[model samples]
Target chain A: MKGNSYLSRKLHSLLGVIPLSLFIITHALTNFSAVEGGSERFKAAVGFINGLPLVNVLELFGIFIPLIFHGVYGLYIAYQSNLNTGQFSYGRNWAFALQRISGVITFIFVFWHVYQTRFQVAIGGITHDQLGMTMHNIATNPLFFTLYVIGVLASTFHFANGMWAFLVSWGITVSPRAQRVSSYIWMVVFVLVSAMFLMSLSAFRGDEFKEAAAALDAIRTIV
Target chain B: MAETTVAKKSIKFVITRQDKPDSQPYKETFEIPYRPNMNVISALMEIQRNPVKDDGNKTSPVCWDSNCLEEVCGACSMVINGKPRQACTALIDKLEQPIRLEPMRTFPVVRDLVINRDRMFNALKRVKAWIPIDGTYDLGPGPRMKETKRQWAYELSKCMTCGVCLESCPNVNERNTFIGPAAISQVRLFNAHPTGEMNMEERLETLMSDGGIEGCGNSQNCVRACPKGIPLTTSIAAINKDTTKHMFKQWLGM
Candidate 1:
C-alpha cells in the first residue's frame, strides 16, 4: 500500500474509472446502432472503427486491457480477501462469488465474440475482418446472434452495476439514502438498455439471421 | 397479574399488533399511567408485566428484544412514532400522545419487535468486509493507521447491524435483493486499512456483482438514518470509483 507515494488506491481507481466507463458507453451505443441500420450499418460502424489510423491501438486497449485488469483485479481481491477475512457470514461472502462469476462470463463472452466476428487473432489463427463479410456472417449465424443478445444484456447490467459500485469504491456510497437512490437508478437503466437490445434481436426474422436474432432476444428477456 | 401491576401515571400507546406475520396487522390501544420521564422501552416493559389490553382482556406480554439498554447493542431498535430508532432511547416525554409502535417491516418478524437481521449480516459476508487476521498471537501492531485516517475508519466501524438503514432504503424491499448501504460502507472501511487493502480489488469486484453494490439506489437515507452518523453515501461513491478502476485494471492488466 505504501510503495508509491503518488499511487494510492484512489489513483488506481482513477486509472480505470474513465476508460472502463467509456468502453461500456461506446459499446452500448454501437450495439444500439444495430437497431437503426441493421447488420450493414453495424458493419459500417465496424468499418469506421477499423479505418481510424491510430485508433486500433486505443481500440486494442479498450478491447483487451480493461477486461484483463477489471476481471483479474477482481479475482485477486477476492482471493486475498478469502484468506484474510474470517469465516464470513452469507452477506459478507456472496459478493466475492458473484463478482468472479460475472467476470468469467464477460471474459468468455469477449473471446467468443472475437472468434465469431472473425476479429480473433493469435489464440488460433488470425482471422481478419471484412466488415461486410462479418456483418453478413452475424446476420447468418444464430449462435452468434444469440450470444450478442446475451452479451448486450450482460454488458448493460454490468455497466449499471458498475455505476453504483464505482461510487462506493470512491468512498461515496456512504449514506444509506444515496446508496438506495443510485442503485435504483442503475436497476432501471440496466433493464431499459438490455430490453432495447433484446427487442432488436427478436425483431430480426429469418433462419439466416435467427442466431443473431435469438441472441438479441435473449439479451432482452434475460431476467 | 394485578399484584405485579406497577402503578403508572398516564401514558398512551397506539400499538400495531399482529397475531401472525400473515395476519393483517391491526392497531391495538393501551394507556398505562406514565412514570417520570420514562423511555419507550420502560413503558413496553410495564405492558409486558401486565398482559391486559385497554379493552380489559389478558393477552401475551408484548414480545421485543432489549439487552444493553444503552443502545450500543442495537437490539432495542423499532419504529416509534413512525420513525425507526431505538425504543430505549425514545423518551416518552418527547413522543406524541398515543405513541405508535410498529415492527420494522424491512425484515421478517419472529415476534412483535424482533425481526431477522440476517439480510444485513449476509450482505457483510457477501462483500468480504473484513481484513484477515490469524488468531490472537501477539501479531503485534499488524498495521498502524494514521490517527487522522482512523477518525473516519472508526466512523464506519460504528455500524451495529441495525436495520434502520435497510428499512429506510426504498431499494431494499421484497422486490429487490439489493444489499443495503451498510455493507457497502463496510466495504469501504475494510478496504481502507493497510492489511485490508490486500482485498480491495475483491471488495470492488463484489460490489460489481449482481445484488451487490448495484442494488444501491442512492437515496441518501442511510446516512440520515444511521444513529452513528456513518457516511453511507460517501462509501458507496468511493467504492464506485474503486470498482471501475479495478475493472479497467483487470482488463488492461495494469
Candidate 2:
C-alpha cells in the first residue's frame, strides 16, 4: 500500500485529539461523578446529557462521526503497517502494537455500549432511574462485569497511549527528555482514568443501586 | 567418480523476470556450472555467458544490476531465497537448491532484478541528508565527535541505500508515502555531524512534514532487514524525540 496521505494523517490525529478524546475524558469524569455522589447524581448527570438540546445532533456529528473516522482510519493504518514485535520488542514497538489493539477493542466496546444504553434511551424505553438500575444489574453479572472492566481498560489505555503517540507524530515532543516528561504525564492519565472507570463500576456494585435494581425488577414483573 | 561429481556440480536458479515496467513477471530457471566460493553475482555472470534456459532454449540473458561485486556498493541488492539482501554476498553453496531471486518491490521494478531507488534518493534530498560545506577554498578541519559518539555514528554511516530495509517495511508500499526507515536513519546520521548540525532545523522540519517521521508506524522491521546492520529503529526513536523538541522550539518562537 502507498504511504499515509497528508490529509488522512492530519485528520486522524485531529479527530483523536478533538471531540473524541474530549468526550472520553469528559465521559470518564462524569462516570467518576457517579462514584462521588451516588445514583441520584449519576441520574442527574445522565439526564442533563440526555436532555440537552440538539444532543442527538451533537452525538451524531461531534462524537459518532469523528469516532468512526478515527477508528476506521486507524485500522487502515494498522493494516498498512507491519507488526514485528516478535523479533524487536522495544517499549515503543510494543506500545505501537498495543495502541492498535486497544483502538480496536475500544471501537467495539464504544458501539456496544452505545447500542445497549443510549439506543434504549433514544427509543424512550429506558428512563434515567432505569439507566442506573440497569447498569447496577449488569454490573452484578460476572461476565458483563468482566467485559466492562476489559472495555474500560482498553479505552483508558487507548486514550492515554494515543496521547503519547500524537505528541511524537505531530512533532510536539521531539526531544527525548520532553517525550519522557510527556510520557510521565500520560502515565498519570492512564492511572487516573483507569481508577475513574473502576470507581464508577464500584458505584454500580453498591447495595443502594442493587436494591433499586431489585425493586425495578419486581415492578417490571408485576406490570 | 570425478566425472560424476563434475556433472553434478551445477547451481540452480529460479529468477523472477519482468520484461518491462508494467509487464507481468514470470519465472525462469537456469542451471550454471558451479564454481567454488561463487557468489550470486558470479553465478549470474556465468549465466550471462550462456544466455540459455535450463531446458535448452535460447532466450535473453537474465538482467540484474551490480557493481563492486562485493556487498559495499549496494547496487547488487535483491531478494535471495525470500530475504532482501545483497546478491554479491549470497554464496551458492550457502543457499538452498533453486535459489529464488526477485527485485526489491519497495522500489518500482525497472526490468528483471533491477528497481529504481529514486524514492530513497528523493527522500534524502527532502531531508537534506548531507553536510552543507561546499566551497572552493580549503575549509578548516571540522569538529571531532566524541570517541563514544564516533563508534555508533560509524555504524550508522554504513547505510548504502540498498532499499532492502524499504522493501521489508510494510509502511513503504505504493499506497503510503512513508519515506521508510532508511531515510529517517540517515537523518539521524546527518544531524549528528558538527557541520550538519547547522541545517538541523531544516532537516527536522522536513521530517515533521508529510511522509516524514510521522509516517513511521514503528514496525521495527527496518533494523532487522538492514543488510548493513544499521540501528534503524534506534535512530527513528532518537529522531522522533528530536522532532518533538524542534516543534517545541518553534512554538516558543526560539
Enumerate the candidates' DockQ scores in order. Answer: 0.11, 0.26
**Candidate 2 chain B: 10-residue stretch with minimal lDDT:** B1-10
TM-score of chain A for the candidates in order shown: 0.67, 0.92
lDDT of 2 at B222: 77
Instruction: Give the interface RMSD values of the models in order.
Output: 13.4, 4.5
Write the residue-wise lDDT of candidate 1 on B62-145 in tens digits.
Answer: 888888888787887788877789888899999888899998888887777777888888888988988887776856677778
